[model samples]
Target: MFLTGEMLIGQQSVTGSSAPISAINPATGERLEPVYLGGSEAEVERAATLAWQAFDAFRETTLSQRAEFLNAIAIEIEALGDVLVERIIAETGLPRARVEGERARTCMQLRLFAEVVSRGDWLDVRVEPALPDRQPLPRLDMRLRQIPLGPVAVFGASNFPLAFSVAGGDTASALASGCPVIVKAHSSHPGTSELVGRAVQKAAAQCSMPEGVFSVLFGSGREVGAKLVAHKFIKAVGFTGSFSGGTALMNIAQARKEPIPVYAEMSSSNPVFLLQGALSTRSAALAETFVTTLNNCAGQFCTSPGLLIAEKGALLSSFVESASAFMNESSTNTMLTPGIYEAYEKGLSLLNDNPNVRRLAQAKESDLPNQCRGSLFSVGAKDFIQDESLHEEVFGSAAIIVECDNFEEMVLVAESLEGQLTATIQADESDLGVAKHLMPTLERKAGRLLVNGWPPGLEVNHATVHGGPFPATSDSRTTSVGSAAITRFLRPVCYQSVPDMLLPDALQQSNPLMLKRLYNGDWEV
Candidate 1:
């Protein structure tokens, strides 16, 4: 694999003819080579056309073949090893250890999806036998199975460069679901993107997969990406970014001549609820854990706890003191990029200027460029309930504590929140009654609920859901993480009165893959 700043398009190396784009080291504000040419609309068209051309063949591959191809991608990525990790660290301003861990996660998840493919459960095959002499007319033989939704356009993420980028969950899941993928590399990390993109290309070639099964492009402006989204051949989209960016893609997809699905994991101000009992028992410990989780990655994670709801009391005061002590001693950490740092500063300013909000804590200094200082704010429940601005996600190490007067006020505060990726409830046996009361509301407001723990790191597995209702994501029905993420790029298809000879393998009676499936109106795994 080589870094040529050339886009990979269906086994072809395309050097863009538009303006050049380069990766920048966020920590030092220095630009790094190779300077990638900005991709044009024509390139996007070419990729989409090729992907659609390849889809029929690619999607028809046996499960073992697709699984092996995914495994090959993981192996190729591992082969890159240190080069990949170091480049990601410099490009994203993340630490060496953190970058290494992310790279490992990237490979781990790819292999996980490979296992999912081999298992064949994703086909979701169901069958019903014909009842030729039934009372209400004979029920025709019918079989149901899932099929790929064709080519997918994935927008690499800025935060998790590897796990959510060129070969990230979006790409991995799309590929696993048998969709040819076209990735628009995030501008902040083109070098890293190129490396990983090349690894995928090598894997596809090595595994004898069709060309255009995976393509990566570099775009300097929104036109290149928007063009990809609006293309008629792209059947679905996968994105992880800002609300504006995600919605832009969603609107383009919806307005298309043939509308497509857009699975966009957007912003979230994950809220944490501290019940009276939990706060009374260990407010100090809770505060300590909150500060630590709040400061992780300088609070860039989508699941980072950004708001707190609690009733005003001595315990709440003690918690604030503990949090304040930690904030005072906290040192500024370098953020992902200058744009993000600037946005964070503006968010902090919004909190600082709000008349109803009081500053709860602030770090002493922001001594370096692109460094983010931790801050906390507090406001009365009445103001939080009234001001919609308070609900907007700040996207950094900043949070607001809503002080409610009583249980009813706390419930009101909970009811006022917008959709989130996660919502936490810190409770004990004594608070279970109120906690139970809050469940219905919380379930409606969030995709994942937590008990006695802050939301931060997400586990990538079969049951994990890294999605929520808007503005957390464009569609709440599908997740953008874990094994279930594959469903987003697949659609259920039913075959009726089709002979066994013509039936899709998964729907055939023999069950060649030996997968558990519904048979004769009985449920199966």
Candidate 2:
């Protein structure tokens, strides 16, 4: 497979008319080959028009057929092989092992959604027979089932090029739920996005899917994305990026004459709470694990632990000493892009200039371009509570420790924090009372509450939730990962007094799909 620097718009490889964008190797600061041309409103119109045309036919596809299409996408991605791996490494400067792991995760999630589709649980079908009784006015027959919202617009993320890019979770879940997709590829990894986009295009062809089922667009600035979000045919959106980008999309979607839902995952400073009992017994071990989690992938993950809260004492001092030792030994890593590296440096400077914040430890400096050195800082609990700047995400490997005077202050710190993707508690059996006290506050602040675990290792399973309240995600009721993610692209519709033959397969009287459904106020398997 070769890179062509063309946009895939419904089985057509069209050249763009806007300014071209190229990928640069962040590790060595070298330009990559084959610059990709940017798209304009005309391209957006073409893609959205095709997507709307294919929606009715694609949404009516059988369960087995749609599931097979998803599985075919996974197979096609795996077939890309080393070509995909090398391109991803060059584009994002991530290590080969990490890239390989992300590729596996990407395929696993696609297959997982395939299985979810085959099970037919996402339909949530229900039926109620007509009652022609004489006691009261006769009731008409009514049936209900969830249906896919129209076309969707997905914005790729810069950090995870494979698992969260052109054919990532948003695309997989949206397709599984029977919605056509139009992707706005991230500018930082155009070559990688093109490779994956071609694979998806091939899969649609091999599976005999609609021609306009999926399309990929490239844009260097906000023009293409804004046009896609504001288009009348795009019924919903799935975004993963900065707060400014996500909020901008949300505002555009809401301003439309027919407003749409934007499931945008923006920012999170996933906080970790260190309890007294666990810290006293395993301070050294806990410090080692904390630093390890903090430095993983240069702390580029959305779920990275950015804030730590603990009571002030010798136990806390020992934990700090051990953590500082590990931080000093940590190696510098190349970031995803030059712009990301610059933003990280500016964030460090802000903390350095603050009067209440004191630097605790920092890794050795490196002369390499786009390098990130792990850093740790500390501030009093009162200062953290009063300063809102301490709660913002830095998007790199930097963490803050809030030293509290007592348990009450620790609770107050947790209460003062903003919404997060995760909140972790390091506790022992004796610390259950303290952990119990903090549970309600954490439950309100974070989407996923962890006991004795880190937050970076996200699992692609049924029960896992990769979303949260407010800035963590635009809508708290939905998740952007796991089996439940399909619900984000679906809406319930009810049929009243419709004849049996005129109903959809899932809502028919014969129960053709063998799905677990609510029948006449009773559950039937």
Candidate 3:
């Protein structure tokens, strides 16, 4: 239960010989104890070797066994209790309630994947019997099932240290798909990562899993991550960070002798479209909720409404005035790290200095270290459409409103956006026609679309999408959260005319696993 600055490699605790790294408490600007040293290519090799060794056995585990292993991870994480909560709060400077909620979400994701594994649905098995006496050139018996890609390399994110770090969605889904995982812990919260890493280590041991089923490594820079991605043993990757960081990993993965898939969730502005009818009836109320969503968690959420589009009118002016009043009264919030705070300040300055952009509201100043002050800015639709810099994400509690001359201009503004994680439409019954007209563009621009709702928090469930196109993530066909995430680590293999005795349990003639499969082009319930 004690924190020791070490890299976890196949159940062994080894200290890194590279540069040392320590966490800083963003709230008070004080550095915490237990400095974690960085790992090099040597450490990456050890973890990669062990993971490759464990892949075959781990991937062939029975459905019940894999489900039990996932459940055990949840149990171990919950067993950490208040120690986990406190460490998370100190390392990230997030509020106590937020930390606790994130812990619950982490465990919830594990259990959810556990259920996903037990159902045997992700295998997508199929079988076709041999037609010995039939038609032209009799068909050979065939059976197909999804198989796990080898070892996976996962990179953590600065925000959501618990829910999106050590044992977050990426790790859970990969393990569920029967892939071994090697996590590259985020530098901002090494102590917290170490604590949760130990929990996973204990779970693997208790469940009698392979030694390298899970491991965590620390590094200050790109050396460890880059080396891991380039290693021949790593088959796929899962990453969550900035656009530059994600693209860097993608480049490494693609440049390898044998390229691998990298699912990296990078950037998103999560634009919100305010329709004319909705603004007219509830401008004051919409302003209140908009400011609330804009400043939630200091607006660090990837789903935060960073862009708002509306037609210029008396109603839109009223909405802006009310939102500015609320913004001035908004409280300053502590960010996760000093570097993140600095980047946020720089983003605000760019908007403040731009001639095409007009600053509408600025929150009260704060003397506290690493705090975020809410900001609101506005620009004409033409400027927003012409300037690509205006489309870039700020990564903090700053939002830009686009004032359009008419509905046509609003539609044009929507078309000008890049790929996003989510696109929200605030509309009423009267605005249904406009909403319908804009649906096709929004569908292509984002992965998830919302109506009459804000985009701040995400629900972790069976039918949730936490991914998008292009810069939002490297791959749009897959999601980084929910049950479908298991598909990312899986690829199908078909066995033709294989001996019945040698067939896998799921694809055998007797249907031993009781999975719902496609048989002879018909459903086998």
Candidate 4:
């Protein structure tokens, strides 16, 4: 299918003539095809109305039916082929291989959620038998089961246009949980979003699902996204972007007539500490690996290791020199968008102008437009602790190595750090004492901890936590990836003294869904 600029609302193709948005190639500063228009407040109202109409039927769908619907979406996305991949690269300025890889990942996660839906573990059912002979008053029969919240609003991410965008984790988990979704397409990649949004619409029709099961709107966050969050029909929101944007949405949700949850993945430096033993033995290799991860996708990843903590010594100095050489010599890479490129420049200038910050390595400027050359800088632990600007994320191919006086000072630095999505400790068996000492602090500091490995590689599994406290994410009580994400769009309902005929299948006496449940004090048979 060809890429259309029209927004996908229910079963209709909507063209918003009021306001328009278009994609631009960051590498060449050229505007691509498909000038997408923004939907009006009336359009947002229509989508939410349809979703409310479909909510009851969609939420009551059988596990097998919902699982099949999710699987159909994955198949439809796979069929998009080169049409989807090319548009993503054109809009994002990323390499073809990376775009292709992201496409496959998007499909893989959708299908994975299909399997999870079939498994039915997210329902979290509980049963308690009725009692008639207990004390003066008999205990009543009781049962509890999880149900889908109302429609969900997702804000597509500019970084991972595929994996974290239109049909990414948030949408997949929300759909799998039987909640209708309305995605606010990122202005940076409207064409790509339009294509994926159509694929989802096609799959919903093929599966004979409700008409308003999914929708995608094109516009800036201010006009379209803010309207969607404030709409009373929307029960929850999911976002992945900057701290200011996330916090803004969070405040909007909280200030609503009826407050709803907003799960936003925001800023994280993902600090990495170089232990004495590991730096002494493998400083060269560690430096190389650090530079490689820091420059991946122009360092657009949320898990990029932006901070390095190490003690002041010749070993640490060698690591810095090796890392600087590796970074400065690396080839120039195209960033996601021109705005991000300009922001990266401003961030670098902020650090450069700071008196306490020292520039260690500066990559040669590239001849290409919007090309981000790698850079490395250094600062003392005391300076870093005192200056709040040092803790802010640069969002590109840049990192700062903080050299401390000793392990105690490094511990103090770690304690004073902000929340992170990931924190790593590169150490050997000989450095177990310091590693143990830092484990507790690191555990409290980040959602995920690593040893002797880079942090950019995120796994889509049950145990993975692609979230953190405070600025890392809005709600640390839940996650935005993995099977756990389904819970974000779900709420519990308890039935008291209800007849089997009246109870939902998941909570009925027959155990019709065959789902695992907690009965009294025992697990389901």
Candidate 5:
């Protein structure tokens, strides 16, 4: 069933008693369906009231029960994997392999959070008792525990519909944290969103969750999103999108009478610095890797290295020539959505028309349906540094080769970068000597640091930081792609002078939660 723009309350899609808007499929450039626009003042209040009702019981539910619900959700998502993949391919024009991988990632993310909940230890609480005889004097027992922050608003991302949309990390993590979620479906892939939404609803029913514990709202208007962010019931927000859109929501959240946290993973122009020694020794290998990095997934990844700073010389010229040739020979590709396609063209046009920029190679249009070719551009390091627009992200199979005169010029270019999700250093033995100087500078400019490697394959582990500063993400301290994602859904709450019986299971000495924790300066389980 096509999911219309209606407020999902309990297990039903209740159309708001008002006008609505249509959600389109970008691949076909067709109107798939219309979603009911949410009603004004009274409707917002009603939605909030339902969420509050659900929260009271949902928050109090046992962790084991919550785990069952989350696990069920994961299973349901897996069962519908094929259906989800097909819809995603049709709506977003993503290759089948790519869609399958995203589906796996989505299911993995859900199961990961479920395991985190099943262990019941992510909420690990710590306690320290004070002795009256001690020199520090008698003190009350201090305890720490993580608690949910009420209802959350999740903005669906257009790029990775399954992994970042309804039933995605935001919804799974929030639900795992005992917080209800309201997802604003991305217009680009609403059909895929609805399929996943149905799976979530199925899981909620099987696990007997509260009626309003999760709601999926659909609309195509800016006002719909503006109202959702401004709603008093939304205690927090999760966004993954462009800088302008993310920042706009943040401003609205801040303007609230009582401000809420808005976790927005914005845009990034991840940079790569190729040292002279490395470029001189491994020009061909570096060129191939650079081509793969820039053209991977049509360069739609957030960590795509948009800028390349190489020392000015014959080595640099060779690297540029090989990379340009590789991109030209690569197949033309379809974008995730038409909106993205338009943006990519516009960004490319802007860079191409700039007087300082020069086209290195261009792809010829192919007969393949829905496939658009891409081109490569370059400019001198001095010119790149002087032009602010050169730094913007051009989301497609494109790369900018910046030729630098020497190590000093390379460092200057590195220093000029805005916050990024990652920055890679292609260095050899001799380059390592200089790397000591460049690594620190690069670390300050990005969240993740790579050496002689690519940044596209994100590992969802404890050490991975999928977020960065400013344009890379609104907050560098949190990540949205790994187990660390739990941090986004949790806030610490201290239990002061409460009796052991009154203390949360997470904090009790008996260790009922059985989660990994630090106790008396040692790991405990």
Candidate 6:
């Protein structure tokens, strides 16, 4: 089924003068539908004005009312179910199961934020009573509260249409925080984004939300996206895509007269370290896991293990052989988009041409359509660490094996790594000694640390951090996935000497919202 774009403003769908952009099915390379691109700069300004108008009232919405709105959005998303999943699969060329999983994750994230808002304390307000007996007598009570940052600009990611697009984390968190959203749909899967945008509008209308509370813009060119970020009305931005693309948006945000925070999750080479002892213990098991990790979703995941560090030994050799054999035997190979397919082809060609890199395994066929499979490459630790190009992410079903001469070489390789989303360690009890020594260095290099597992499957919980430093993410303190994501949509504000009734719900002494908070260094329920 094809879905077309209709501007969602003031809780309604409005047409614009912008032409249509074709949304293609990556799996079959067929055009699914043409979605309407957004109109000129004036339209964007109008939308922003609407959002600013909505924010005046929406920000004052009671916690219970906001909770109901968010919960309704979650329910609407769940109700879409298979229809939404199939559309995502058809548009993005992802498998049905993967799309369904993302849909569930998207719904879960919405519901999670709903629950978080329901509790009210995510605002994390604190109150300290004044003391007259102290040497430096406190004259007044002190309170801290978190407030919405006004309109948010969200850029949809090509890889995760459901999880990072219209109804994705950015929208969910922003709405939950009472900030209006204007999403710039990814050109690759505009159809899916349109459908999801409809769901968001449905939820908004059902909850009596303002028309400007949510808006979705479609554009084939970068100009529209640039204009959205550069707009003065936009208070912040949320993005998930390639390092170059995210960085470009960040540059635009930074260049603004009044700079805004751009929480952009860029690229990362999630490295996997396999200790010699673990390899000796369960080389076959390790090989099977490696194959699964490399081939999972055709290795398109941002957290996919792109670099594998292993000690030079017979076990490591056997693991590589088994992994290559398994990958060759696996028949399932379809990319999410033609752009991804082309990128994969170019990355493989570049690796093949590298003098220091050896193609450990190549797919048997090259002329195949979307049936193209992943490949494996190996290089000595000296070469892998010395070549800066080797550290860059290829964004495909390819793994680079770096053979280290000893534990020290492994440590050196680990130390040499740039910022990463995750760094995995496959080891047993004996390897803990080395892990202990490496943990400090790894902690400095990565945002998340994993043990005996891969990093592709991200959990949408409180602890999950889908971000890292620099290349992994534009900022280290923010994440694009998980409950912590709400932080990006909010900023703290302190009110002093304000009347109890005049203060925000978060700062009122009555604690009318009853939200959770950290009170005097203690967690208050």
Write candidate 5's Cα lDDT for 1-525 as tens digits.
Answer: 455656665577766664455545544666655454644545555556677779868987888889889888888878885767877887787888988888888888888887777776667666665445766667666778888888888989987898888888888888888998888778777667778888888889999999888877766656667787888888889998888899999999999998998989888878888887898888988888778767666788888788888887888888888888877787777777767878888888898789889988866676644454667788999888888899888877777888888888888898888889999988899888888888878888888999989888787665778888778888888888777777787888887777889986778778776666666556776
Residue 151 accuracy (lDDT) in model 4: 97
lDDT of 4 by residue, 1-525 (tens): 776789999888999855778899998889988788898898899899899889999999988899998888889889999998888889999999999888888888898899999999898999988889989988889898889999999999999998998999999999999899999999999999998999999999988889988999887648788899999999999999989899999999999989999999999999999999999898899999889888888999999889999999999989989998988788878999988999999999998999989999867788888888778999999999999899999999889999999999999999989888999999999998879999999888889899988898688888888888788988877888888889999999899999899999888888988888899869985
| Candidate 6 weakest lDDT stretch, 10 residues | 363-372
Please provide TM-scores, in order, for all candidate models, with all chains considered together: 0.98, 0.99, 0.99, 0.99, 0.93, 0.96
Clashing pairs in 1: none
C-alpha RMSD for every candidate: 1.3, 0.8, 0.8, 1.0, 2.4, 1.9
Candidate 6 TM-score over all chains jointly: 0.96
Please report the TM-score between candidate 4 and the true structure: 0.99
Q: Relative to the true structure, how large is the alpha-carbon lDDT of every model?
A: 0.91, 0.94, 0.93, 0.90, 0.79, 0.83
Error of 5 at 459 (Å): 1.9
Instruction: Report lDDT (Cα) of residue 302, candidate 2.
Output: 97
Model 3 spans with C-alpha error above 4 angstroms: none
Per-residue alpha-carbon lDDT of model 6 for 235-267, expressed as tens digits? 999998887888899999999999999998888
- lDDT of each residue in 182-246, candidate 2, tens digit only: 99999999999999999999999988889889999999999999999999999999999999999
- The weakest ten consecutive residues by lDDT in model 3 span 452-461
CA error at residue 147 for candidate 3, angstroms:
0.3
Q: Roughly what TM-score does model 5 have, to 2 decimal places? A: 0.93
TM-score of 2: 0.99
Off by over 4 Å in 5: 1-7, 16-44, 366-372, 515-525
Better of 4 and 6 by TM-score: 4
Quote the lDDT for 139 in model 6: 54
Give the TM-score (vs. native) of candidate 1.
0.98
